[model samples]
Target: MKSNNTAKSFDYTGLKRVISLGLSQSKGLFIGVIFIAVFSACFSVYRPYLTGDVIDNYILNKDLVGLKLEIFKLIILLIFEGILAFFTVYLANVVAQRVIKELRVRLYNHLIKFKLGYFDRTPNGVLVTRSVSDVETIAEVFNDGILVLLGDALKIIFIVAMMYYMNWVLATIVIVILPLMMIITRYFQKALKDVYQEERTLVSKLNTFIQERLTGMNIIQVFNRQQAEYSKFSSINNDLKKNYLKTVLYFSLLFPVVDIVSALATGSLIWFGGLRTAAAGDVTVGNLIAFTQFITMLTAPMRAIAERFNSIQRGLVGADRVFDILDANETLPNNGKKKLEKVKGKIDFENVEFSYVPNNKVLKGISFSSQPGETIAIVGATGAGKSTIINLLSRFYDIDSGSIKIDGIDIYDMDLVNLRHHVAVVLQDVFLFNTTIFDNIILGDKSITLEQVQEAAKVIGIHDFISSLPNGYYSEVSERGSTLSVGQRQLISFLRAYIYNPEILVLDEATSSIDSNSEELIQLATTKLTEGRTSIVIAHRLATIQNADQIIVMDNGMIVEKGTHESLLAKNGYYANLYEVQFSKMNS
Candidate 1:
């Protein structure tokens, strides 16, 4: 969650992690890129040196045969260098692409295992940015940042060696400018890195804002706040523009200064090298010409050094964000070794206590039990801990002090996957993927065939509805099934749960928001669903649970009344008052 973009020192540890991820699956490609780069550097520097060789040894002697042979050798050298350059870029890109793919996979795999609470606190856009754009930035580190910098450095070293070998005095003149160039380059690198970090942070915030605003655009329109939202977006857009301009300004300034310094070095090389040639016949014209070429070659890498550092810092910033999620370790513990092949669906909550936050209990010493093949109805007003019971039963959140058991075995001792497999929950708001109705129902479970889906839909009394669609079972559902009516979507949810054939069924306000006709259909489906399974129904509507074997009335996280519908009404207590009030409202 924290970004280290503006840190004064380089993050060598993060760089190591990025390198490790790149090399994890593509070590051969990475090694090949490095090897190609080394050979390419040698060819690049040697070409300039060879030109000097041609000028001094062959061309100066007026030997046509020697000049032609040297020209042929120069041509061959250029060809080999071109080939090496091509492979260097190609292999580095391959390594980068492979690393990015591996990084995305690792990030996604880590995110899927994180507990619900982690998601509750994190923005959807932040995670999306990290997984996508931020991970993509890391590719530059391999292709254009680290490897390119390495090759350029190697080339500079070879050019310096050649200069020193040909004429030490001229080499010293060129070398004196380097220390100053490095000092300036280092300063710009640090400055650019800090600004880039701030820029990246702003980008994340901007993405988060855009994602949230788009998701809630309907609310903005309904509330007549379009202009207000637009203004907010404009402000963020302006800030991003300013940040980008700052980057451009720094780059514009840095490159010109580098060019100016390179020009100074070239001037000094010509002035000093010319003097020695004119005075004592010490320095050759070929050596002076070659030194100029070496200076030009050295300037390229020198200028690129700061730019490459910027790229590396950008990648490091991205790597930090990605590794933040990868190292979160917020996943649920699946230490339980017990896997039940078949669960009998006996559920019990004994003296349960739970709180999403400390000292703010959502469930207070709650005790409940449902025998196999019995439907237990839980009734409560908003925030009375009704849905919390279902969540606890599903082990979505661990209890602070209690034991939740299925078939008299503690749920903690049961494999999380197996426990969820045997338990099915149908929420009031059903979520369907933007996919075919059949695919949504099967959910990639290869065992659930089209035939099985149709049969399940038929059993749930929704087959006729699906058959009426243009594409029948293959009809596409929009995002969150917005294209489907609430009733129709509910039916799809019912069919999905039914096909699973879970041992325990949880219907959490399943029919509370639908029309009477849809409710009636769902009522029939519910009856079929809870037939022989231990079922838990959380409802705000009293009439829906009148036939429930036992009705538990909850108030402020405690059960105040519990009995059959008749028994609770006869007692004329909390349940009776709730039932009377709901019926009066309906009749009114």
Candidate 2:
């Protein structure tokens, strides 16, 4: 069953926020929709009056011509009301589409600006749910929920007015049952609201759980943990199912109660009308018929209000969740006025210090420089902050206390877009979009031509493989490049990084996942690619970096040694000890 458990919480503040922000985006359309609603309501109430008038003044008097005229009036009014209804639906939808568009864009803009730390700490599945499903839920509110409720309320007001004007006694009788229905609605609403909020939270958890499991399916299967995973998934799925069933149960109980009230209301109208007709007979037959119709209309709105209220409440919950994302203040502050059109690769890290968590520094007073056209390799034990250095230099995360500069200017003062443009990163685990190979290589940068990409791929030795594909460069890839071999995907990463032609290239274990045959191919391409550009390599294979101009070895978040490979080996220090241990294990 489809779930209605995605409401975060019951907060009118979110609805108010949406109205405040959404109005400015499509105010004119909203105003037009309201006007159409008002016109339709006013025009519809006239028909009941006309129905009674046709009977009392024409049919009762046996004036056939007059009755025909009254009938014509009703037909004309119906046409006018139909046109107004069309306008209401069309205008409201346009306004809803506009609001949804602007709202999604705003949320996405905020997501892109958020600090990397937020992403590191937050689950990918939660973010994806916020961006995709939650945003879509908000759109339903605009399209069908609140706007429909507003129109319904107006129609009910007009209906009540007509009923009272026709006969106050009958109006009073119908109005009595409404209070009872409303009380029941309120009670059910409270129960459902909490359930809705819990359901939404569970959806995110389930998404995160499924996403992680699918991502690590290989590990799970290798470890033979399928039964364990199945049990865990069953528990979560059952929880979601229970929440939905509760919602179903509440609704099931609600509508039947509404139907019972509706039946009682109709029964009372007939009994009262007949009693008066049999006695003093102040109420005419025409009035009796009209009162019955008016009572039915009034009860319809009473029944409908409950459903509309639920829709509105659900919308409010969605709005609350979306607002939470928009209100985040954890975005990286990149407000530099400096803009560099071009940079000559010269990177310096002075007294750099950082921590993913406070009171635990990852890089401790580190200092280093990469001169232009130099290949600098970083070797370190795990947790030595080798990857942390690459992350800081790329401005993916800021340092705690230090100055990182490019071309003699602090990167903190440079435009974030421009600063990142000069840096390229190729990770050991490559990620590929589900798109054509050409599109993947170009990465939406229209300035780079196809010829340029193919040429770069050729130079990097991936062109032949791409050409062998059914669609060549235009071949469609799957999510994360699952369709391609590990070596093939890694090679594509090199091509993608190379095509950008960044001044500073950082390869963080880029060749670690490749087999020996593929490793040899990358070894040949690495030299040609790193030439005439400053490069930073992080690798477990010492052979790849033996010819590097400089080698920095780190231990426990501190750089303990730096020199040429032979020089470091000559020192027989920590680097030499690590190399011997690793190579000896390989030989064994």
Using TM-score, give the best candidate's number: 1
CA RMSD of each candidate after superposition: 1.5, 2.9
**What do the candidate models score in CA lDDT, each in turn?**
0.87, 0.82
Candidate 2, residue 531: lDDT = 74
Per-residue lDDT of 390 in model 2: 89
Give the total clashing residue pairs for model 2. Answer: 1
Task: Tell me the tens digit of each residue's lDDT in model 1 across 37-70.
Answer: 7888888888877888888888788889999998
Q: Could you tell me how far off, in angstroms, the CA of residue 274 lies in candidate 2 after the best superposition?
A: 2.9
Candidate 2 segments whose C-alpha is farther than 4 A from its true place: 1-10
What is the C-alpha lDDT profile of model 2 across 1-588, one tens digit per residue? 122334433456677777666588888777777777788888877778788788888999999988888888989999998898788777767777787788789989999988889998899888777777777667656666666667777877888888788888878887788679778878877887787677777888899999999999999999999999999999999999999898889889988888888888888888887788789686777777787677667666666777766666666666667778787787887877798877778889899999999999999999988889889999988899999998998888989998999889998998888888899998888999999988888889999998998888788776777899999999999989999888788888888888988899999998777876577668766765787899999988887788999999998899999999999999999989988998898899
* Model 2 CA RMSD to the hidden true structure, in angstroms: 2.9
Worst 10 residues of 1 by lDDT: 3-12
Best by lDDT: 1
